[model samples]
Each structure stands twice: as C-alpha cells, then as structure tokens.
Target: MMESIVDSMLAQETPAPAGNPIESAEELSSIAFGFMASKALFAGLHVDLFTLLADGPKTAEELAKAAGIPLNRIVTLTTALASVGVVSISDRKLIQNSSAAQNFLAKQSKYDFGDYLRYQIDQQMYPFLLQLNAVMKGDLSDDAIASYQHWMADEEQASVYSESQHAGSLGPGRTLARKVDLAKASTLLDVGGGTGAMTISLCNEYPDLHATIIDFPNVAEIGWRFVSEAGLVDRVRYIPGNAVQAQWPGRQDAILMSYLMSGVPGEAVADLLRKAFDALAPGGKLMVHDFMVEEDRRGPALAALWQLQHMAFTPDAHSLSVGWLTEAGRKIGFAVDDVDNLIPAMTKLVVFAKPS
Candidate 1:
C-alpha cells in the first residue's frame, strides 16, 4: 500500500511524456537507486581513497596497502568509483579520473570538500532521509528528529556543521560576490550566517564593506575563527543570537540570508522579511539566496529532493518559490529588483530593494 502511494506521488511529481514508458521506468529506477551512488561516494571518502590516489595511479595492491583495506575490497570499491567517473583504471592501475578529485576531494588541497561530503551529506542527511516516508505520512513528531537549532546547540555538533557547510558554501559565495553590486554599500548584515562563508567572500570582494553575522552562539564562535583566518576579523564581526528573535542592528545598507529561510518554519518567513525591511537603510538591498522550486511547485529534481529532506526534520520548512518571495517583499514595501540563478537550477538569488 505504501509502495503504491509512493509510486503515485513520484508519477505526479515527475511525470514523463505519455508515450515514453521505457524512459520513465529508467528515470524512476535511477531515482530509486540513487542511494547506491551516494553510498559509493561516501565509502570512497571514508577510506580517503581519493587522497590516496592524489599523487598518481596506483595498483590494487598499492591502494589496499595505502588505504589499509583488503585488496578484494579495494578492487570492488575502485570499480564502483570508476563507474561513477571519480576514478578510472588503466593497465591494472587505478587513477583519479578528474582534476576535480585532486582539487576538491584530496585532503591536501585547499578547496577540499571531503569533510562536507562525509559529515554533512553522508553521516547526517543520509540517515535523516530514511524518515521521509514517515514524514510524508505525518507519523513523526517534531522531536522525532532534532531541530536544527537543538542539533547545533551542542558545541561539537555546531563546530562540525559549521566547518562542513563552510566548504560547500565557498563556491556559491564567490559566485554571489561576483553577481551582486556592493560597491556603494558600507555595512551588510548576514542573518543566520553560519561560519561566515558568504560574509568572508563578500568582504573579500568589497574591501570597504564591513559585515555583521547573526547566528547561534556556538556557530558564531566558529564564524569568528573563519573571519580571523581570512584576516578580515576587523571587517567582519559576530552578533551571536537567534536571528529570528534577536534585535537586528539597524541602518544596514545591505542584508544577506543564504540557505537560512528554508531551515526555519515557513510561518516565520514573513516576519523575518519584515525585520529585514525595517533594519535596512532607506536605499538598502536585501538578498535571499536559497533553494526555490518553480512557482507551480513541480520538479527541479535536486531542489525538490532537498525540500523533502528539510521537511523530514523541520516541521514547517519547505521549498518556497521566487514568486512567493516577490509578493512577500512587495507587501513589505520592497520591490523585487532582480532574480538570478546562483548555481544553475538548484539554487537561486532574489534581490529586493527598499525605496530610495
């Protein structure tokens, strides 16, 4: 019965053309088995297989010796990794298939995001997603899974969460910096700014700009460290508190909320938008960078998946739409100036401006 419901839901959510039954079945199978690929990637990261192959190609015996695993297991894992294009085999040696692995998967690289892949995606989110069926059935209580706030309240958890998310945020942060015009703005407020990734990126782009990051105390501590490491400690400061209830420092020329709104209850978004409007200076701008579905709430597969995953943990959190945000901003007396895709179809940037 549950299987039938789930299949019905998928058919409605991602319907294929009327005559393309084979394509539909293939796509459905791919979606159902996505966990296999995810686990393969996670296994590679767990054993530092990518890092081991960073130097050059390695024979199965060499990989086994380096990774401290059995040769048979190494061969099996490498075959899976090779199938995924992360690694390749040439003349009985395994090689990292793409430069991306060397630059972003190897531990020694500055752009390495292995921790994010391991901790955030594999360890945390993967298990959380097992509850999706229960979540959709409304069988899980709010406390069934810890709220993000409660999860981050523990200093250790907060540290891990902040650090992992920071790595993933860098590229999007850099992209945001390039797209937005902050030249005339002196002060920016980053609401729920975890570890200051976007803040640091923005400050790097606009030397004269200073940023204040508002987030929980533990995350703020981690953010401070990141700011200090960036040598922008003087320009970026932490305001440690719950952004939703805390008193925002007023007179800000710009505000940023990246990947924040979707974590909070949907009912709170309007209030938060109102606060941003009130806190901004007369001509200030407010930016929301997040995962948004199309106005009809159909599939951009990644965004839709993320929305469902968020719903499993966050009671009222769901993927919102750009049209919804534009309407909300209009009610608060701010005009929607621009909307752009920050990361192709997955993430979006919507800019709203206070009337001059």
Candidate 2:
C-alpha cells in the first residue's frame, strides 16, 4: 500500500524538469556548494596563477614553480581555475588568463580589479559568515579596508578600480557619473575619492571638466600619481583630507560622494551630506552616490549582502532608500532627483541640484 501510494504521487505529472522537487533540491544543493567554488577560486588566486599568466600561458608545473606552491596543489588549482572560467587548458598545458581572468584578476592588465578580492582571502570574508550576528547585533569593525589599506595604498586600489568597474555595478557613484552631463560641468570634487579613478575618467571623457580627489594622506599621494600618470595633472588635483573633520573647498560645478557614505553611521553621513551641501554654490549640484535599499529593505541580493558587509567599519551602513534621500534633500534646501537606471542594476544616482 505504501509502494502504491508513492507510485500514485510519482504518477502525477511533474511539470518542467527544473520545476520538479528533485531538480529543485539538486539546485539548492548546488547553491549550498557555493563555498567550494569560492575556495577553488581563492586557491588559484593565492598561488598567483592569474598574475603569472598575465604575461603568457604557462604549464601547471611552471606555475607551481613561479607560485612556490606544491605540485599537487597546482594541479588542483589549475584544473579548478579552468573549470571556473578564469583560465583555459589547451593541449594539457594551463594557458594564461581566460578573458574574464585577464580583465579582472591579472595584475598587469589595465582593467584589473583583483583588489576587490584581496579582502576575500585576507579572511575578511570571515566576518561575512557572522552576517546574521551583525544584522541582529551590530557591525564587526571600525575601519574601511583597514587591513587592505595597511598592505597597499590608494593608488594600487585605484589602478585596479578604474578599468574594472563597469558602467553600473552595485553602488551609487558610477550611476551618478553616467547620469550627469559631465561635459557641462566644469569642475568636480570627489570627496574621499579612493584614487581619483572615477574623477579622472570623467575629466578624460569631458575635455572641459576639471576634478579634485580628496582622501587620506597616503591615498592623496596615490591619487596625484594616478592623475599624473593619466596626464591629468593639470586638470585633476588631489586634496589630502579626512571627510570627517576636513572642510572641502567648494565653489565647484559638481561634487561626487560615492561608495564612501555606507562606511559610516547614518548621522555621520547626514553631517557630511549637509556639509557638502553647505559647501556648494547656489547653482552647484551635489551628487550623492551610495547603495539604496528598497522600500522594504529586503533587496536586489548584492546590495542586501553589502549591508552586512559594512559591519564594524560604519555603524549604520544600511542601504538608504531613495525616498529617504529625497526627503533628506528636501529638508535641506536642495532639490533631489533620482537618475533613472540607464544600465540594469542597483546603482541609482541621486542628484541634488542646489538651485541650479
């Protein structure tokens, strides 16, 4: 009777294969195995396979020698890299970067963005495992890329950030950059700009525009180097200052505060926003770019995850919704406008035109 009951249940048409319970369970299992995928990638990155291959293809044995890791580990790393689409194997030899790897992981590549993952391996991702604790309790740290900054300067991060950050990733600054008619704006100030990558990109794109990037002392030095390297020395200036206590030099056409907002308490961010607004000329525009949550705060995946990721560095680093920002602007004496999503993503530019 039990067998007959089971058969009867199985006899009912299972719709699409992907929709079937068995398939769904398998899909969930695959999702649960995501850690293995991340570990495989980390192992490949740990050995400098992508950086080594940046020059040209090399055999797994050669990679093992260059990376100073075990031969057995190299085999696993190389094969895993290939499986993960970061490398390609041709004729039993491990080739150099696959297109994706070259673009983001290869250190030498102009579009390299591997710095984003350095934190992943530094065990900073360990905190993310404590995400629930963060949500229920509070953040885990008091610094922004504190360990990472300890290792590399802002220029290092900028070099990688410039080429790799696509049009609309998962944040606000890039969104504002795309939406603004940068050609019309003559001057821009990137407050706490990491390495002036975004500002310089704007200046390069708009011949008439000039920009200034401000950050910590060392990061400012790096920003200057990037500006000089880009041959934007005359156009983009670097100001070494902290956004917390430093007074920004205003009187500019526009200001960009991106990615920086979420790394602090809500009150602190508001203070900076107000300060930025006060610094702006009546006709100037203040552009605020940061992650914005939905009305419910349960989100578009990546942004939701980012909320947990900001723990310890910035107390109330939750994603502020559009409504929240618009209201904030209205309370202050500026008009807040939401830049439509030209690219499909979570990034939305909030433009607060100061009577311009």
Please tell me which predicted candidate would have the highest TM-score against the true structure. Answer: 1
Pick out the ten consecutive residues of candidate 2 with the lowest summed lDDT: 1-10
Q: How accurate locally, in lDDT, is each candidate?
A: 0.83, 0.63
Instruction: List clashing residue pairs in candidate 2.
Output: 139-312, 140-312, 141-312
lDDT leader? 1
lDDT tens per residue, model 2, 170-239: 2233334546776667888888776676676577668898887777676666557667887988888777
lDDT of 1: 0.83
Summarize candidate 1's per-residue lDDT along 190-267 as a digit string, tens digits.
Answer: 999989989998999999999999999999998888899999978998888888888999999999999888878898
Clashing pairs in 1: none
Candidate 1 — which residues are off by over 4 angstroms? 1-26, 91-95
